[model samples]
Target: MAKLIALNKPFGVICQFSGDNNTLSDYVDIPNIYPAGRLDKDSEGLVILTDDGKLQNLISNPKYNKTKTYVVQVEGEISDDVASSLQKGVQLKDGNTKPARVKIIEEPSWLWVRTPPIRIRKNIPTSWIEISISEGKNRQIRRMTASVGFPTLRLIRTKIDKWHLGDITSGSYVTL
Candidate 1:
């Protein structure tokens, strides 16, 4: 069986195990295990790691169409029209994205404080939205929201297919 680990990777940490600073090695010390998929250095939340190569490929490969769910805080009050656009597919520079499930939501009560925090503009309003997509384009969620006019201010991946971030705390991991 694969040794699977679910980690709540904090923001600013790189995905790889080796780097100059703030890399996975700092949090995960188990040798030979690798991240199943990647999150941006600036994006915080769940990152799955396993020693099984096939399992890693299954989670990261776009062809598998494993769903990834994110809670996003975007600039401005999000609208039904924006949600609908995301659900129908949005035109991106890379090409049109697959339709995503999107809905405006109140800030997640389970959310924790981000390190250094997101910028706040007192004049511009912000809103929270949940988005679930099966495709992982490079920075897809951010690009999708920006394409529809509400730029994402903060992003947190909460789920990846059957595995979830759950209650994993920042910079911590739990073996499964």
Candidate 2:
């Protein structure tokens, strides 16, 4: 039988199974399972792992259009115009992204304090926004925020399609 696991990948952990830095293998002792999709080393949150190749494609492939939700903490207070701009799909170097669902949200209480923490400026205020995008582009969220004048200070994936980060603790996995 195929096994599916959701791992809460922490900041600084490499997405690959093997490397000099902290890698999936450090936390996952399972055999043959690979990450369905990847998160950048600086980004943290839910990573789905599976031994089934077909299942992996279904989750990772942009064609499937799985809705991936991210909670982002950006450097400045988000304006209504910026929120609208993101929802309308901002153009990138690759091209215009698909329209995304975006809204300003309060900092989630469930959010864990990041180790090494994000830098803070005394005068600048930060805002939280929830963004859900169906397309999985390389560093898409980070790029999008940067293009709109507010750079993302921190980002966390809270959900991927039907699967979610849920009550899973950082650096741990929940088998589903």
Candidate 3:
């Protein structure tokens, strides 16, 4: 049977096992396990790992169209126009992204505080939004939010397909 692990990746930790900075090895002791999908160093939340190559491919491959959902805190209040623009797909430097499911949401009460926390602008208000996309383009969420003039202040991946961050604490992993 394939071994699966769900991790709540902490901010500032690299996705790989070894590097100059904090990596999965610091949190995960499992041997031969590889992350199925990647969360950037500044991003937090669910990262699924597996020992099976096929399973990893299934989850990470864009062709599979597995939905990845994020709770994003942006620099300013999200306007209806911004939400509509994101839902319609924003043109990025790489190209236009596929349409995404976007909606304003309250900041989740279950969120953990990030170390070296995001900068707060006393004059600027922040708002949260839930964004679900099938394509995992590099820094796609951040770019999408920036394109709409919101600029993400914090980003957390809350779900990937059927798996979720749920109660998994940061820097922790659960065998599934």
Q: Model 3 residue 144 lDDT?
A: 95
Model 3 misplacement above 4 A? none
Each model's lDDT comes to: 0.94, 0.95, 0.95
Between prediction 2 and prediction 3, which has the larger lDDT?
Answer: 2
Task: Report the lDDT tens digits of candidate 2 across residue range 54-77.
Answer: 999999999999999999999999
Each model's TM-score, in the order given?
A: 0.98, 0.98, 0.98
Q: How many clashes in candidate 2? A: 0
Model 3 agreement with the true structure over 133-155: per-residue lDDT tens digits: 99988999999999888999899
Candidate 2 TM-score to native: 0.98
Model 1 alpha-carbon miss at residue 23, Å: 0.4
Could you tell me which 10 consecutive residues in candidate 2 have the lowest summed lDDT? 12-21
lDDT order of candidates, top first: 2, 3, 1
Write the residue-wise lDDT of candidate 1 on 120-160 in tens digits. 99999999999999999999999999998999999999999
Instruction: Give stretches of model 2 more than 4 Å off.
Output: none
